[model samples]
Target: MKKHIKTINGVDYLGHNALANNKIIHIKTTPSSSGKTHFYWNKGRAELIVGSKVHFPVPSIAHLERYRESFFDVGRNEIQIGDSIVWFFGKPIQPMVCATVVGARRDKGKRFLRLQPNHPDSIVPETWALYQPGNFFLVSNNRINRHRAPANIIYAAYQDELNKIEEIYAPIRTRRIILRYLTNGNLSMGEKAFKECHYELFKSIYSWAGQYRKIELVIGDRQFPTMHPSKVEKAMREFCQDFSNRYLRLVGNDRAKMLNALVYAHKELAWIHPFEDGNGRTMRLYLELVAKTRGYGFDLAASLNSKKKKRYYHFAVRKAVEGFPRILTALLNKALT
Candidate 1:
């Protein structure tokens, strides 16, 4: 009697939720030749036999309708196995195809659905599409392949990408020699030194280590565009020239001038965002090396602990390059030993 729930041929079929062991639970009517109808819950896709005749017929239009309503609606948190999805590629003229959600995986707070196309000629069956909000719509669920399901299939598959990045950084935190190798290099402040720092730290994990990012990059909630790849080299060269001229000369004594140059250097490099990854780590290492060049210790971690500090730093990184480095100067002053 519900919108999608229906009883057909003496068996009650509910939508979606009654699924387990790849079978829909259906309530059957027990035949006793009596006026009273006795209820029985049956679990199977096949017909139920009461008196040598079929009680639950093979899937009808009502069953098909129930399957249609079981798909994951856009923006819904709970994604179930066999939920239908339709991927519309680009413009309206492009072919829209139907795929069944065979698996769901999470990376960095976003859900990705591993889909199997209904037809072999459609989109690649092995594709994992990102399930972003407003990107998908409901289609018919797969009722045919219900027999081949694996045991104990849970819907939410979460693999945090940050955890993988932390795994790469774990050894550097625990070991002193690794830290020494990173910070003790006598490389002069230049583009080569910056690339080398990125390489030495992340070459073990990333193939693109020390390489400038070819693709476009946007940072944080504001989606601030870092320097385009075409302009990265030019920006880095200019920053290095300024760093060598102004910041390097003031390294030992003039704390006021040195800090001002340091703030500019930090702001410029962060805006450039040269490498695809490890830019933050590389910048921190560069700052520490700058401190060491003058026989002083600068612990950048001291100023980066609080949420408010991080929020302001994120704002300053973008704003400082556009205007003045006032907030960044205040933040960097805290890092001085």
Candidate 2:
């Protein structure tokens, strides 16, 4: 039998091409299966099953090392040819491993492949590369890349404005308005009226609160000259129409269902880049509002601050362009849940 090595997190295991999932590669061991002798392919955890056969092009040792550093609690094991294993689960299984195969050790034994943790060939690797850059942008520039500095500044300013809004309203309702403002600044007339009514009711309590401040705006005219005012307006209208239509069709009045609905909607809206100034901020705000309405409130600022933000954004883009919502939806569910 040909021998191959497989790794997860940092740990290395041996397996062959028979282990790889047709849908995704980078498999993860289940938390419940920690320290267990047998491993399996897990979509949720990104693990490959022990004793699974995998086929891989040759991989370098450096590639193996890079893979382990990206994920936590890495391991490796081996598998033989002609072995069949479960790839994904319909329901959560205790002591079950759920991971995508990230890498495979190839050309080691005659006709055998090895699985490596954090494989560059894995989907998670591509997603992680995208995620990391987004993280760096947020940390260094306080926003995601591809936006003009002015837009980022405007977004920052709006966030400050939201803070002021909170001071003048009930915490719950204030949060809801902030969510709507972030998602779509121009709420429907009725929604706007509802927010204004709440604002009036609490004016006495927060009369001293000042107007939202402005950040120094940077223009993207030099970078994306085609993004003129007219183009922006068109984009916004399209975005609004799509969002409203989708919301009506898919979103339920309940909270949990709405949460899922918002996740999908946010992905679509982000792709639209409806606003000339603050789409990222808006999408997050939209998601937050949907969450709050459903009683599953979130602090998106904190979530966006994490390294995973890049992964989240990449997934969103992929879902928008490629029609693959699995990774994007999974990440959103993970974030909210």
Candidate 3:
């Protein structure tokens, strides 16, 4: 054998080995400190080097890359709260499950992640687990079957929308613009501001970004029903009128009453599901602008990808689709600052 090279997780390492013979070899054990096992071909035999130790001739190079992407040395700082991850079971890597990273901490210099199963039926030993390289992987490149989009793609879309919001709608100016229409009782102007959020966020991706959905819309795996295509315009008009009346009536000293009105408007607009896509994103942005007009912070628009927020949002949106606003109202109460 001459010089051997290996690549793992986009990093390459080189090693020189002279076996004076020629036969292919492989190994099937835990990788060394370098996270890769080197193969040195010789005459009818090969060397299997794991760390400073060597095991004899074994398997094949095809199996070397089997779990290559699974053993990334993710830094503790790289893992953020509310990130999605997947954990593998025992040997052979079967029975893998998806989970959300809810918390993080260090105990005695060892990092740990607080995980919650994405599926309620999933069985996990503990909420906290050691941050080991081979035990779990972030869900960035994994393709979701339902939307057929990678998790990283979904996160990128959210980040793009957030960046646009900050660019086009600075908080003070956004608050001024929204309150102008609200205080003047100009529902048309308010609706334009509402739809503009969708246009600004998705005009490049969807031609119909600012328009109402012309086709029937369904939400989530449960197939939550949105308003019929024919009724969307009328529903939105009625919603705007109702929201205008309530906002004017409740914009006084009672912050609690104002929050209730804002929550009601949010749930009603979600029920309408005006746009073909990005209803949730648009609604949250619109809600934030409205909240800013009332002296509340734009918290919901920024953290839409949070796992806990996703859980709460799905539950609240389900109730909204079913024409029940209580759950969504409660969710908004918690979200609005």
Q: Tell me each candidate's RMSD, in Å, in order.
A: 15.7, 18.8, 14.4
Candidate 1, which segments miss by more than 4 Å at Cα? 1-160, 167-186
Q: Residue 29 of model 1: what lDDT?
A: 28
Q: Rank the candidates by lDDT, best first.
A: 3, 1, 2
Against the unseen true structure, what C-alpha lDDT does each candidate score? 0.54, 0.37, 0.55
Candidate 1 clash figure, as a count: 0
Which residue pairs collide, candidate 1?
Answer: none
Candidate 3 has a TM-score of 0.51
Instruction: Report the lDDT tens digits of candidate 1 across residue range 1-337.
Output: 2212343442212233323332333222222335323222233433222223334432321231112221223334434435455554343332343455544445688766666554444434456777754556543333223232111111111112222333334346424333564576665667776777677666543567778888778876577888899998887888898898877876667677667767877888888999876677777777766665666556766565676776777777677878778877887887765
**Candidate achieving higher TM-score, 2 or 3:** 3
lDDT tens readout by residue for model 3, 1-337 = 3333222331111111321232433322223476554423222321223323334432233223233322223323244333456655442322444555544556798877666555444445336777786766555321122232212211222332223323343454445556665576544426777888777666534556689988998776777787899999888888887787867366666767767777777778878889877787677768776766556765764335565877877787777656787877776777767
**Poorly placed runs, candidate 3 (over 4 Å):** 1-139, 143-189, 301-305, 321-323
lDDT string for model 2 (103-171, tens) is 333343422223121223222211111111111111111112222122221121223223322322335
| Candidate 1 accuracy as TM-score | 0.50
Give the C-alpha miss distance for residue 25 in model 2, angstroms.
53
